[model samples]
Each structure stands twice: as structure tokens, then as C-alpha cells.
Target chain A: MPMHSPTDTPLFGSWPRAYAVVLGALLLEIAFFYGLMHWFA
Target chain B: MSSLDWWILGGTIALLVLYGLYKSRGKQSFDDYTLAGQSLPWYHVGMSVMATQASAITFLSAPGQGFSDGMRFVQFYFGLPLAMVVLSITFVPIFHRLRVYTAYEFLENRFDGRVRSLTAGLFLLQRALSTGVSIYAPSIILSTILGWNIYWTNLIMGGIVLFYSVSGGTKAISYTHLTQMLIVTVAMFIAGFLTVHKLPTDMGFTDALRVAGKAGRLNLIDTTFDVKSRYNLWSGLIGGFFLQLSYFGTDQSQVGRYLTGETIKQSRIGLLMNGLLKVPMQFLILLVGVLVFVFYQFHESPVFFNKQEVERLNAGPLAGEFQVLNRQHQGLSAQRRAAVLNLQRATAQNNDAAAAAAGDQLDKADEALAKTHAAVSDLVKRNNPAADKNDVNYVFLRFILDYLPHGLIGLLIAMIFISSMGSIAAAYSSLASTTVVDIYRRVWPGSTHNEVVVSRWSTIGWGIFCVVVAQFTNRIGSSLIETVNILGSLFYGVILGIFCVAFYVRSIGGRATFWAAVVAEAVVFVCYYFDLMAFLWFNVVGCLLVVALAWLFTTLQLNLRPVRVADE
Candidate 1:
């Protein structure tokens, strides 16, 4: 099988963007969890 | 356990073992035995990776954590996705391209044999000891529920996994994991549903959440920047990142999972899938614990969850004192239950003032209840000083046996055992492969031994060693999950530091890197011994210290060495 280098490919048009998407999702999770804690606490 | 429950538990485990062995049939070569012939798809690799990580302790203890500490523990995994991304980018391609048997093999090529041996030795020590705890965890719970001796349970549990792992190698472990994960996911979801279903008739899931929240059980996030805190946001992201990086990147148990992938892309995607799914999965598991907490608020819970210890207290000289404590606990439990019901009703009626007042009552009741529970812990400690006073591990197990119906109880128990099997098998296989490929092979470079045979014997040997270690795990005096992580943190940082130097710092030579790792490891141990900071920071400290010290040593060695003349 051919190797797909992490830098060469893009899940969202670019590698950096793919990384950003992951980080962005993590931030969203934190925000949502914080909100849940706030709403419930 | 009833006859029907026994049938379910025994049949489920039997089916798993036969299926694993059947799927892994016709594996003769060392390559096929160790790596499943690199034929598994991304999903197999992904499931295997997840199974190897989500051990029985995770399923059993995490909900207990949620029950006691709330959702702040979820932050401990916040750095996982980031670590996954980093591993997929750097570690995946390199490992796959090299087709190495163990992660430490790559270390050898990048550095030298001693570095590989040192890192592999660290992995062997940590994984074997941690696997022992993994075996002991399910055994303890099963023993408690079934009234069996823990020693016999440990032997039986460890022996069963060892049989299959020795028979089919990594193929069996991976195939079993795929099935194991599917069943675990379903069983846990059912457990969660049943926790809610058993709540008070008028209390919906939302009401349960409100009760739990008011009791401070919904602490999902704490954005505070306290260095001494273990699971706050910043510590989780930074310290957790380093921990997970070292765990998935260097730990042969984890690396062995991804290494079974057919291609680099397969491995990368498998790791990415883990990253995407892990946090939510952990959240749901913890949420189940919170729900269980809510369930208990409307009902009665044990004053001390460890029934065995409670039984000991009942039979001992402290029986009267224990009875007094138990009566006090009963009083507090009743008050807390009443307060929670009031809070639930007020929230349902949208009476904000009433809800606030009830919340205060609930807090007071809970505080008193905690005091009674602390007294119970003290009673246990005074009765038997060698006993593990923390009952967090028993919380969920006791709930399952006490409340859940027969068939589901069996399935949940099966799930715990199967999860334990997955991780323990992976640890055995990884330890065996590392020993055979890195240490054994290098120490006797030209021995005409059958690699496959050596690998099989090594698996059996390590399995025995781990099972022996399991016997001593009862004395660790902490939650099994935390103990495992604490143990890993001690070594993972130094290992990661070695890899970081190997991959990123080109100028750092083998000797310098090696000594830097040794010095940094000592510092980590000293820091942990003196309670310098939370365990997670050890990862960050170990990695950075190694890199900095290695660079310093390398630069100093170069500068101090005399230069040779060009003419010569």
C-alpha cells in the first residue's frame, strides 16, 4: 500500500487545516463541558 | 451469580476465546504471530488500539471516579486527541516504514543498542507491573461479588488470558479485541440505561443531572491554572499531552496495536479514530457514574462499598464501634436522600427559591455523609492496617451486583473480564515481542533459535511473571486506575525524552542521551517521592529535562574534546 504522508494530505484541504479542525473540536468540547458544568452546577 | 448469569458469563468468554483462536488460525511464522501478518484493516487496528487502552480498570473505576469526583477526571483525556495527531504524523510513518517488531527497535536504529535496551527495559517493568494490577482489578471485583477467594480468582483470570495469548499470539488478541470492544460498548450503554431506569419514578434523567450537579458531581471542567492540581484544564492538556504521547508513542503495548495495521495510512487512521472517539467515550462512561450517584441519592448506598472489608469489621472487635458508625451513616443517608428528593421536586416545579434552599440542605447532608464515610474508612484502617482503605474501586461493582438484574449483571461482569483480557493479552504480547526482538536477540546476536518459539515461551513467561505481580497489587493503597497511571508516569516521561531526542535533537549522541535519561528519571522519582507536583507533570518534566540535559552534555563533550589537525 502507498503511504500517505501526514503533511502531503489534507482532511480539510490542507494538513494545517486538518490539525486546526482537531484542535477546534477539542476547544468546542471544552466549551461545551464548561457550559454543562455551569448549567448544572 | 445465578446459574443463568454463570451461563452468560462463561458462554460469552468461551465464545470470545474460540473466535479469537479461529480467526487467528494458520499463523506459523514469527511475523504472523507478532504482527498478525500486518493484514488487519484500519478498523481492526482501531478497535484493538481502543481495547488495549480501555482496560477493565477504566470501565470499572472511571464511573466510580465520576461518582465520587465528577467530570473533572474527563479533562485527564483532553490531551489525547492532540497526542493522537502527533503520533500519526511522526511515529506512524516511521514505524510502518521500518517494519520494526517493537517501538524500541526504532530507537536502536536511531541511537544504539544500549538506548534500545534501556527504554525496552523500562517498558517491560512498567507494562508487566501494570498488567498485574489489571488482572487483579477484575479478580477483586469478581471475588467480592461471587464470594470467591481473590487468590484463586487472580490465578483463574490470568490463566485464561494467558492460554489464549500463548495459543494465537497477537492475532488472537486483536480479533478478540474487536469482539470485546463491541460487547463492552453495548454492555456499558445498557448499564448506563439501567442506572437511569432504576431511579425514582418521578425523577427523569434531567432531574438526576440536577441532583448530581447540585451535589457537585457535574464538575466537567475547571479552567484553573493550579500546578498542584492533577486534572484541571491546563494540567490535563499539557501534562496529559506528554503522558499520552509517551504512552501511545513508545509503550510497546499500544504501539503493538497500531503496528498490526496493513499500511501506514491504516495505522494513522486507526489512531485518528481513537483520538476522535476517546473523549466522548470517556465522557459517557463518567456520565454513567454521575447517573449512578444520582440513583444512589434516591436510594441507600453502602457506608463502605467494600463488602469484604465491611464483613471483616462486622466480625472483629470493633463491631460495636462500626455499628455506631454505620447507624450514623444511615442517618446521614436518609437526610441526603430526603434533601435530594426535595431538590428534585422543586426543580420539577420550577420553584427556584425552593430548589436553592433544598440544594443547601443537600450539601449539608452530603458533608455529614462524607464525615461518616471517613469514619468508616478510619474504622477499616484501624481494624486492618494492611487493607486498602479506598473503596472507590468497589463502588460500581457493588452497585451492579446489588441492583442490576441477573442477565445484565452477568454481561457487565463479562464485559469487565473481557476488557481486562484484552489489555492483559496485549501487555503480554508486547512484552514478549520486546524481549525476543530487542533484548534476547541482541544479547545473543547469532543464536540459531526459532524466533517464533522464543516469542511463544516469552509470552508464557511474562504472563506468569505478571500474574505473580498481581498477587501483591492489593497493597498499592490507591485506586487501580490511578495507580496504573502513576506507575506509567514514572517511566513514560524518560522514555519519551529519549525518543524526543532521537527524533528531534539530531546533535545529541547516544551516550549523552542515555545519561540524560538516567538523570532525568532520578529527578522524576525524587519529585514523585517528595510530592513535588501532580503525577501528570512528571511527563512534561521528564521529557524536557532529558532533552535539555542531553543537549548540554553533547555540546560540552564536543567543545571539550581536542580537535584533530587537518594534515593528520
Candidate 2:
């Protein structure tokens, strides 16, 4: 599906992309925390 | 402030402003002004979301919380990950598809214009006041450390943020947040490590935890569903979930963070990252405080952690009594240290009885030390009526200043300022955006002819308003971090309720939701005023009340449906 314009009825058009984004963000956060705790401990 | 300190602060702020303005050089539409044209990558959005949440108060007061209360505060974030997941499934996709500038903008489309305005107003009031506290958190440190006028410090701190926010808007705020979060993470880690290094040669990190645990500092999980207790498993999961949901899902400051993402996927990812990391990040910060608590157990600490208060007591009529208490504290510290060492040895040998006996002795000594500290603090307060008697806010800063190496001290202090800058900048941006979009643009449609100048001036106006609010920020007690959270609870539930009704209860029209919200907010305030429940419960109560009331109103309206006039 083409990306919805700003004026579209709903904001996001794709759930797959949304899920992908959330997963990717979660991984990055986990990595950041692991490094942080290990570095300090 | 010292010449060097002033130079460091001034130079850092100047560079940020110049960089933001430099990058802001372009013809920008409303999308560019507010959402960075929705072009930022996932990393930028993630950092922005993190920075917006991790305010200066997190650094300034969290360690103090640990120093006094222990690691239990970490549980406050347990609900955050779940909140993130829920928002991903619910709020993110809808908001992303809506392409709204402010979260409340979507409410109007779903419900009515009145509901949108009410939600926006709640957000405006809460964000403005909370931003004031955020500005005040760092200003208090600069004022106390440098003995500068807090009024002027508030202006300087708030103004610096306003300058950049007004210049580059959301894009500038995001880029700076990325840098600030990086520095904050590294500096905090170093500070935590250095606290352990300051402990006696025989003690290690594990030893510190054991000592802190004995001292009642490592109380991480409290399963009891005590509404009065601020940090516990239930509050963290249930109450905190509601709070976080309202904050990230409804609050424009946070909504603006994810709104900067290039795609819905990117925005959801950034939020998910936040949800996943927030609890652990909070855990680590609180752990630093717990470790600091343990470190103090094996070493002689001050009778009162607030040095300024101690100095005043020494110069006052209570000087003699204070000295006597100080001497007594020293003796108690010596006994406590010996007792702690014995307990550690007994534990190492797996001698449970001996360990218990030694632990009891250490606890007795700790009690005596606490009495001495209380005496000193009381004396200090008696001498100076305006004194900050609660030294919990200063516990970690005291340790850092007295023990940390020179370069690290600068870095840690910088970390506090950087965190402060990140959150304050985000708040400033949010405030400006809300003012311009919700109030200004709404009131004066087709007045976009002077949008840029109006936006800049609105940023300046809100900056001044927040700084003014910061002036009355003193004497808010030790848990400044918790104080902000509690304050947020006051409005977040009502705001969240409006959104919940908007997203899920399509049958509830705007007027019903709007009036229901006003009543719900009043009820929350009444409960708070009468001390009917814990502050955390307000989030749950306010949200549930709004939804229930809105549903009732809608049901009533359905029954009273007006008959349409027949066409003759």
C-alpha cells in the first residue's frame, strides 16, 4: 500500500511495518541496557 | 559559579543554540516545524523519546532516592514495557495514520471539537507546570552549588532551552537528545562504578549490595498492593501502566517524539524501544543509589549529606551541639564498619547465626548514626528556616563531589545538565507546538500568514512562564523525581481517559466525553485533596472514571435521541 498522506482518515497504513519498527527499537534498547549494566558492573 | 564552570556551561549552551539555528536555515512548512517533516530515522526517534522522559530530575534526585530508599524505585518501570506493547497495538497505528500534529487533534476527528480542546487544555496545563519543574530541577543544583540567585539561574537555564527549541523546533530537539542520551548513559555508568571504587579496598560491588540490603536499601520488589506506597510491584505494573500509557500515548510531548519518525513503523519501533528499555534504565539508576548506600556503610559518611546546611550549623548557635553529634556519629560509623566486616566474613563462611548476630549489631550502630544525623539536620533547620533539611536529594551529589576523580566529577555534573537540557528542550518544543497548533491556530484560523514569527514568540513566552514557575520550586522535599511523577498523575489519567474514549468508545460523542472529563478531573482532585488513596491510584481512577462517565452520558443521549422533523 502507498503511504497515506497527512490528511488521510487513519494515520498509519501498514501494521507489518509498525511491528517491524517496534521490534527493531526493542532490540536496540536491550543492547544499550546490556552494554550499560556490564560496563558499570 | 567558578570561572571554569561558567565557561563550560556558557560555551556548551552557545554551541547548541548556534548549531540548532544553523540547521534550521530553510523554508519550513508546518510539518517541518512540528514533526521534522516525519523524516527522522528510528535511532533519532528512540533517543528523542528517551531524552524526553529522562529529565534532569532523574539524575539529580534518583541517586538520592537510592541513597535513602534503595533499589525499590526500580519497580516503578515494570509496567512500562507492557504499556509500550499496548500502545504499539493500539495508539501508534491510529496516531500514525491520523498524521496529527498534537495527539488531541485526533480527538476532535473521533469525538468532537470540545473533547479535543479539553484534552489539549489538560495537556497544556500539565506540560507547562511540569516543564517548569524540569527547568527548576537543574536550576536548583546550579543555584545551590554556585550560590547564585535561583531566579537568575532559572532564567538562564530556561532561556537556553527556549533559544534552541524556538530556533530548530522538533528536529533540533531530537538531534540534541541523541547526543545528550549518549553522554548521560556513559557518565551515569562511570559515576556508579566510581561509587563502588570509593568503598574500602576489601569491599566489592557484591559486598556493597549485601551491606545495602542489610541497611534496607536493596528492597527492589514490594508485592503488597498498598495504594499509599509509591513504589511497589502493583503500583509499578498497574498504576504505572496507566500513567505511562497516558504519558506516552496521550501527552503531546511524547507523542511529538514518535511523530518525528519517517514512517509509522519507525515511530512504533522508537516507542517500543522506549517501553522495553525504560524499566531497566530506571532500575540501573536506582541501583546506583543503592550501591552508594552500601558504599557509605563501609565508610564514614557526613552527619548530614547537605554540606551547605552543615556549614551553616557550624556557624550558628547550635555549633557546639552539632559538633558533639558529629563526634558521636564518627564513633557509631567506626562500630558499624567493624560490624559490617564481621557480617560479611560470617556470610562468606556460611555461618548463618554469626552473620545474623553481626547484622543486628550493624543495624544498632546504623540506628545510632541515623539519630546523630537527624540531630544535625534539626539543628541546621533551626538555624536557617529556609534550609533544605532533606539531604536525600544531595546524597549522590555529595558522594560524587567528595570522592569522584576530578574529570569524572565534571562529566557526571555535565550528565545532569545534559539530561536536564534534553527533557527541558523537548518540553519547550512541546509547549510551543501546543500553543501554536492547539490554541493559536485553532483560535485564529487562516492566520498562518505570520506563523513563523508567532511560533518563535510563543516559544519565548512559554519559556518565560516556565522559568517563573521554577522560582517557587524550592522546598519540594527529597523525592523531586517522584514529585514530578505524582504531579503527572494528577492530569495524565483524565487525558488518557479522553483518548481511551476517543479510540475505543466511538458511540460517546464529543460533548459527552468533554463534560465527563471535567467531572472526572474534579473527582480525582477531590480524592487527592481528601487523601482517599495513593497518588498512583489517581491515574487509574481518573482514566476509569472518564470512560465510565462518558459511557453513561452517551447512553443517556441515546435514550433521549431527538426525533427528526419529517420532510413535508
Candidate 3:
């Protein structure tokens, strides 16, 4: 995917990518916690 | 407290307050006072937003939550990232474009004054009451650790912030929040490290986790579909989403935080930063609590974490009975320590059977200890009918005081106090702006009252109001953070529903949406009053109820309108 619009770049290169990073981070954290839960369970 | 600790506490607070006042100097108008002239960069907006949400209750009670309830409570913020995304895509852009001081201002254009006024009113009521609770959370720290009167602590806590908030407005709040979050991050990370360090020599971090996991404190993700379960993943993701969306998207305390952003992109980035950081931050805080749980498994734990209450009960007529319970608590603590040691050894040896046996013994010992604590609590209640039965709020405070080094203890207290000030300042400013922009200015457009003067008075009025509310907060029986959230859940959903109607259901007029919100709010309250379901789900129920009722009422109106028009 295009990382940024050349004329109007913002944080994380673009708005969509920025949002994707946040949502992606949430997924990663949830996965880590889930693994911890089961590993310890 | 030691002299070194006192110096650290006093110096840190004084420095932070002076820094805020310095950074916010020379704000000229009500706009500058309320929105920091909307000139802050994304990082300032981000830190300010985080600080506003994380009140004293967060630092004081979240770890206590982790200590008692386990890692599951971290799930409650699962929906927050999703809420942030929605807000970024929709709410931020519109609020920025409209150039409204309060989020409710948009409602007037979208619907009418009544819808806007009602939403603003709901925000004011919830924010003020919760600000009182926020004040009470730090007051607990002072009253418990310093052995000061609760009333005096409440006043000091409320008044110190009031002075800055009234004078500096959003500019002061933003700078203070930046400092506050920095202190919180550094203090909590150090505390987490110290908690693990305080554990027995043989226990590695993984060993501690294994012991905690065996004790069921690591139940971080419950994928259960049960509606009544409070901290399960499903509710956290769905219900928590609505609650958070309403909170950040519509609640002026939060809206005011981001509205300080220099531009739309800045605001969105700030919120996105919060989304990315909050869950992990909360997880670490709770993990510290769990580690403290691990720490106590090795050392002797407090029967009741509120030392002041325990000392008070000790001096009472039932001192003999309390001593007997104390002896039982010591016995149970010894048994628990032994079982935990065995469990730790078994886990180290990788012997599953021995570990399971030790875990059972540990559970049994801990259960008996919990019962003994309950009996002592009952005695406390009998001695003073108004005593706070829940010690969850004091668990972390007691740990910091009893265990941490002197200077560090002061830093931690200062951290919690600063956090309380940040949120209270934000709430005070938000309340003032909503009062001025939504209620006063709109109500009396031609009045000669200076907006800045009225705004200052409004800030002071809210400060006094919240302080009064703080006086009654001792009767609240739950963990402080949960109490604040539960109070918020009562109104947030219906308010979010109104916004959803305004944003989505274009056919639904203002009157239908307004009345629907009122009726839906009543139903949500009824649900809450009866303990109908887990409080998180009330967010989902209330939001959906308003949407459905508004749509239904709109349909009825359409069906009846033509005949009335023809008659006319």
C-alpha cells in the first residue's frame, strides 16, 4: 500500500496507515495476553 | 514519612504546579482559557488526553484491581483503540471544521438547542460527580498514609487544583497533564521493577508469573460470551467500545483535551497515540499489581490494606476480638507463605503434580485468609456503621508505604496527587466551557457578562460543587476506578445514542432523538438500579435502546404528521 500521499503526509505517513498501526498494535497486544493466559493456564 | 520523603513530595508537587502556571502564562481570552487557543501539537494533546482520563483512582486503584481481580481487568480497555479510530475518522474532523468550543455545540446545528443542552447537561453532571470521586481517591492516600483528617485532605486536594484550574484554564491543564503523565510513567515503571525485586531471591520474573498464574491472577483474556461477566473480551470489545466512544467523542472533558490540538491531524494523531499507548500502559500497571500479589505471597500480607481503619479498629472496644482475628490472619499468612514456597519450588523443579498439589494448598490457605479478612471487615462495620468495607482502593497505597524506599514513596504519592489534579483541572475547565458556551451564552446572547469572568466563576462553582460531592464519597463501596466508570456507564450510552442518531439517522429529528435519549437513559438507570447485567454491557444496551427508540418514534411521527398538517 502507498505509505503516504505526497501532498498531505501526516503521522505514520498517512491517516489510514496511522489507524492501521493502532489497530494492529491492539491485535498484537491481545495476542500476547491470550498467549500468556493459556501458557500460564 | 521520613524527612527525605517529605521534601521529595513537597518539592515535586510545588515544581509541577509552578511549571504549569509558568507554561500557561498570558492567556488572554475565554478561548485561550478553555482550549489553549487550539494551538498545541499532537504530543501535547496526546499526553493531556491520557492524563485527563487517568485520574488518582487509576494510579491508586488499578493495581489494587490487579492485585485482587488479576490481569482480567486490563481487558476493560480493549475497546478503547477502536473508539479512537472512530473518533479520528468522524468526530475530530467535524468538531475541528465546525470550530465549536464544546462538542454539544455541533448538536445544535445537527439537531436543535434542546438536544445540545441535554447532552451538555449530562456531561456536566457525570463529570462533576466523578471529579468529586477523583478528589477522594488521592485524599485517601493522604488520610491513610499521613493520618490526616479525610475532610481536610479532601479540601486540600480539591482546592489546590481549583486555584490553578480557575486561573490557567485549558493551558494550565495541558501543561500539568504533560508533567503528570511523565511522572506517572516513570513512577509506575519503577514501582513495577521494585515489586519484582522485593520478591524472594529464588523467584525469577517467570517464576513469579507461574505462581500468579497458578493462583488465577493471570486470567487476562476470557473469551466467554456471558453478558454478565464484567471483564471478558467480548464485553470489553463491544460494550467498552461504546462507553469509550461516548467518553472521548462526546464528553467535553476529553473533547476539550484534543480540541487543544493545533489542527485536525494533530488531534487525530493525539488520540491515536492514546489508543496505542493506553492498553499497554494499563496492562503494565495491572502487572505491577499482580507482581505485588506475587510479592505478598512471599512476604506477609496485610489483612486489610487500609492501615488507618485497622489502627482505628485496634483502639476500639472490640480490640480483643480484632486481635483474635489478627492472630488468625497471621496463621493463614504463614500457611499461605509455606504453600507458595512449595509451589515455587515445584514449578522450578518442573514437577507438575507437586505444583498442582501446592497450588491447591495455596488456594485453600488464601480462601481462609480472605474469610478472616471479611470477618474483620464486619467487625469494622459493627464498630462504625459508615466505615468503608472495601480495601481494594488502599492495597497499592499500603504497598508503597510499607515496602518502597522513602524517597520513592514520596514520588509515588506525588504522582497520584498530580494525576488527580490533571483530571480535576480538565473536568473543571470542561464544566466551565460547557456552562458558558452551551448554557449561559446561548441562553442570554445579548447579556453584557464578560465571557472570561463568567467562565472563571463557572470554574470556581464547579470546583466547589465537586468538593461537596467528595465529602460523600466515603460511602462508595467499590474500587474507586470502577465506581467512577459505573457512574459514567449510567449516562454515557444514552448520550452516545443521541450522537449516533445525529450522525447516522438523518430522518430522526431532534425531538425524537432527545425524548428517545431521555427514555433510554431511564431504562439504563433502571437496569443499573436493579443490577440487571454487568455494568459494561449497559453501554451497549443503552446505546442500542436509544437508536431503536429514536427510529421507532420517528416512524410514528411520520405516520401521524400528514393528517395534522392537512387539518391545520
Q: What DockQ values do the models have?
A: 0.45, 0.10, 0.45
Chain A superposition TM-score per model: 0.73, 0.59, 0.73
Candidate 3 lDDT, B322-409, residue by residue in tens: 9999999999999989998898888778999998999899889978987998998888888877778889998999999899999999
Query: How accurate locally is residue B267 in candidate 1, as Cα lDDT from 0 to 100?
Result: 79
Judged by TM-score relative to the true structure, which candidate is superior, 1 or 3?
3
Q: How high a TM-score does candidate 1 get?
A: 0.96
Please give, for residues B87-205, the per-residue lDDT of candidate 1 as tens digits.
98888888888789899998778777778889999999999999999999999877897788778889988999999888877888888899888989999899999999998788788
Where does the lowest 10-residue lDDT sum fall in candidate 3 chain B? B559-568
Model 1: residue B379 alpha-carbon error in angstroms: 1.4
Q: Rank the candidates by DockQ, best first.
A: 3, 1, 2
For all predicted structures, in order, the TM-scores are: 0.96, 0.90, 0.96
iRMSD, all candidates = 3.6, 7.3, 4.6
**Candidate 2 Cα misplacement greater than 4 A, ranges:** A1-41, B1-14, B558-568
Cα RMSD of all models vs. native, in order, equals: 3.0, 4.8, 3.1
Q: Single out the weakest 10-residue window by summed lDDT for candidate 2 chain B.
A: B559-568
Q: In angstroms, how far off is B25's CA in candidate 2?
A: 3.3
